[model samples]
Target: MSKEIRKFCHGAAVAAMVGLTALSASAEVSLNVATVDAAGTLRNLAGNRLHTLLREQDAGVQVRHIEGPVLGNAAQVRDQVAEGSVDIIGTDIAWAAPYSNFLKATSFSFVFRDQEHLAGVLDSAMMAELIDEIAAEQGVRILGAAVLPSRAFFTKVTPQRAADFEGLKIRSPQLDNWLESYKAIGANPTPVNWNEVFLALQTGLVDGAHGLPVDVQPNNWHKAAPNVTDLEDMFGVHVWMINETRWSGMSSADQATLVAAIDEVDAWMTATAEAESLSTIASLLDQGGGVFITHNAAKREAVAALAGADKVVAFPEDEREAMRNKALAAGKALEGQATWWAPGVLDELQSVR
Candidate 1:
């Protein structure tokens, strides 16, 4: 062959290879993440970390975060994700019930002993299967559970006993069993959306609200209520989810990378959330603007008595037993798994006790 012809063929081969490589890289997937937390909060940490990890995994992959109520409340975000209007969302199980009745199982109060128990349950095969089943039905995918501590009641008035809650109106999301539980104790439970909670308290429309100290303190609920009662209620298990249609459209390699990124973000979120809740509570008390009250031992006993012998009678007999059994079984199955947080976060969670 002539020297000029040989050089021309070599250059064409190089150009073809470079073009294929560029095409493959450009095929990377992109997703949008939405959360209820505003700027500079631990709640945004999970989404932020996942976004970073996804980028690191694939240089071409992109994740855009929409924080605060930019996409409406958590419930609205979930609906948007389901309808494919949003690519991803972070929301709690309570919000999932609107999309799937099976999620009702995860809403059972006190079903988990602590964050570790809840983590174990989510990581279990049975729970994973259930989540997948629900996700398929709802047109979304459960990436994993975001770690948050148990919620407590913050009030302006100090309660000497459970009976002290009598006639006081408390703010809560509308959940029938939860309402019934509060009503059974003589307190009037009122449903209020998160956006309206601050006003509800400021106007004395509600005397108290239930939330994690870290969650409420960041918003300065202490300024409105001035008193917080560590009435350990339910642990909040928020799920990181993505629209199934968007997820299914991703390349297999990109999907694997995305899942791994979510796992790392979840671990970071769990550690940060638990630490922040405790630290915020201390900060609030130190500010001297609010008083932190421990539940009266006798009053706590009375509340437990009302809950019944199972220590989780807030639900019907069959339901309560089923939750306990599932949690215990999940704990046993995850006994030595490093991902399960051995000795359990249950011990660390007792600090709030």
Candidate 2:
């Protein structure tokens, strides 16, 4: 234990500590995020928020965004995420049906009455189970479900009654089940991509396009067709997912930070989507010069006949009936309130809480 030897050993220990600290600081992670929405669209909002949150949570981590068709459409992005070609993707549940049957539960016609019902299901244990199954089977992680408004029809020819849809050439996603539903309604369902929808309508390639008012208004779909129908048939659910391998490779601290950030963003997205729905409908009517058609009960029943009521419950038949009874006890939660900024919305949002 000479003084010189003691000094040298102490210096060596200090140097090792410094080196380890530097190594940890120098670690860098990069992730690629893909989405079908154009830049600045609500679909891209979640992606952008995620990128910001990641950077704020970890300066060493970097996220890159790919919008439009760069990574292909939403359906293509799902495959890319599963194959690890893309590190992350914002996708629709309808497109993920091929990979997971749990999605079929959400796909069931009229499963949800409005945005609140849809949000309730997404925040429920059922959606968590579905996400976990997808993660295990497809090798991708579901961050959260991004909300959107209920989908309705925007047609060139005004349909006062559901019978008017007969023989109409309507543009819809090429999913066979979806097309079959439209066919059941007596309309000729033409499958077309979102990018091709405008031209399809303008050129008379299709007579109508189906989507949410918020989705259709932003895209200026009403300019091509003047009539908007409030069928309230379907709503949009965008699932944010990341490649499991990449997520697993991250440090424990980074993984926690990423998940927490996504949870916060999901909460914000739900409220934003609810607010946007009303403004979107107004914009379509006033700015886009479209006529809004409110269907009567008989007409709605006709549309329902075409939409068909198919339920997918995870429980046995007896248990399913019991669950339905429980849901009925909840009973018409949003009844008699059709507009946003209504009195019961905050309570409805809280009920799901």
Candidate 3:
């Protein structure tokens, strides 16, 4: 969480605490809101925002915030939500892919043009159908989703061309799509748990890691591998979901309140992400500890906008196009092998404006 959000959520929590305490004895709804990320992360802040909203919206409703991995990791917490052990959770949409493989499509790098494109598909009828299917099949209801910081390549050495990535070891989660994304670029994708990425990089266990600047900064991985390639290839979706049983048990008005609260959280998340993206890059450059590289024109423009274009290393245009072509081909091929998605689902997502 940024200072701005931390301050706002802190004040909101204080005010909400007073309001909820006044009605503590008579509160009607008690929700166990959980998130796996640490206190300063976007997902954690979303959980805080939800708690604050529920309290301010209804004095009769009480929300218990579990802000860290006290319960478990992302997959474990998501499972808890389905099992009703956790009332609500904020985590990666990809963690829910085991219940519905259609969600895997969203994890493919370069699959969506940008945040607006992803958000459009999230709100589209197709996504609604997918969510409803999950609710009925896996007993989880997705309330809303926010775009996570885009995953970029943070390496020890900057690659100036497509072939420069050949045989490079990139640490990644074991997700099939994500690993395949790195493999598609001719890079050797190694499945390393996120918690181990920093050590893995430090010890030369991997040549690079694919992740967000926010993650790199907080974990201080930049100190280990200071070269960053901002492919902006893929972005993760941080979803707010509730146990289907819990959702169904709620009064219709309470359900509406939950959804409305999440909508505001989502809006705040989108705005925060946009501003944070630029500031993170600026911070990285200001520290003079990392070399940031990108071939994307828009990303270059963004660096220029921040007046840090001089600090960004440019990847060759031809190499970028070649890499893009290969990545697209690989994404399409992976979709063909994954039979879980409804026929034509990928097409529908791509067609979304």
Candidate 4:
């Protein structure tokens, strides 16, 4: 429903109107694509890029973009894919967690400090192992992954110090890891879905929000709750995936086309995210928005204290801690490396036995 998506959809419709329909006939296979985010977001960026590359390769693949609720909500879209009704989807890691722990590993405490660290660690051998594990267990084929902007803290009531959160009700996703993450970070977390966020802040159902720039800027939440704290505690993570049955049904040539197209999208996304994150944050502030708080070492430390505390609500608390510890160890090993941007962290995450 965003202006950009509307424009694309309109242009496609217009192209058909003008008798450009012959070009689409070259498609040997066509697939449906959907994303929950608006057009300008990283999710849609990946979606748009895939659509172009697949077509350019005349990969015989026609991709249709179904953005926002046109197809369904996140849960419904994912369910459709699992049922083999929806061909492909672009979804963030948090929403994909019910599928497997591999999807949520990116969200584990401090696993990724910034987009650079995220790009670095995700490009590792360890991540490959997890991706295949999830595919085997969950019956989905992960085409590729991309790093979203880091989720930071934004509040209406500027905290003079960390203790000011006595009654603070910051909003987070309904997912348990996010709930625990917000609680662990020292604020009263109010579980809310993405759609309700703007109104939640507008009417004071919540005090502030903890999400990435796309979440805030697209909805104009900056007009309501203006102060931002750059904790950079977690990177928003998303994966491009297809149902396993559909994936296996495709010809190897078609499959190869998808892999190549997705690789191109991933490369473009990594660079664009690094360039866009800061400027997007500042764009919100330039037009009569709110104040940007310098980084708060104390609040970050407070959140770091709870890392691997066994408090994750998604799985057994004990099990969650063990999972987090593994991620923390791997993440710690990756810190301050100049090799963060190097490609091919692993070609194909090792296959599952």
- Top lDDT model: 3
lDDT of 3 at 296: 72
Candidate 2 lDDT by residue in tens digits, 1-353: 22211111011011111212222324677888887876656767777887887777665667887776777777778778888999978766677666543343344334456667766655543344445455677887677666676666777787655466778998877665466446645578899998778889899999998876666765777888856776444677776678877766776545555566666777677678777765565556565455555433443343334332120001133432333333333322322333212233223433443
**TM per candidate:** 0.72, 0.72, 0.85, 0.72
Off by over 4 Å in 1: 1-26, 56-60, 295-353
Between candidates 2 and 4, the one scoring higher on lDDT is 2
Residue-by-residue lDDT tens digits, candidate 1, 229-339: 664446776667788777666655455566667667767776777766655665655552555554334433443444332221122334334434444344344433532
Clashing pairs in 2: none
Candidate 4 ranges beyond 4 A from true positions: 1-27, 165-167, 296-353
Q: RMSD of candidate 1 to the true fold?
A: 15.3
lDDT of 3 by residue, 1-353 (tens): 22111111011111211212221233387889898777776777778887888788764456788977788777788889999999988777777667666677677766677777876666543455455566788998777777776777778887898998899999977677667778888899998866678899999999988776765566666778877787767886777778988776665555555666777888788778767876776676666466678877777778767746566788877887788788877766655454444445555556767
- Model 4 C-alpha lDDT per residue in residues 46-143, reported as the tens digit of each score: 78878878777667666877877677777778888878888888887676666543334356454444566666555543444344454567766566
lDDT of 2 at 76: 79
List of clashing residue pairs for candidate 4 = 28-60, 123-345, 128-349
Clashing residue pairs in candidate 1 are none
- List the global CA lDDT of all models: 0.59, 0.60, 0.71, 0.59
Candidate 1 lDDT (Cα, 0 to 1): 0.59
Per-residue lDDT, model 1, residue 292, is 54
Worst 10 residues of 3 by lDDT: 4-13
Spell out the clash pairs found in candidate 3: 1-40
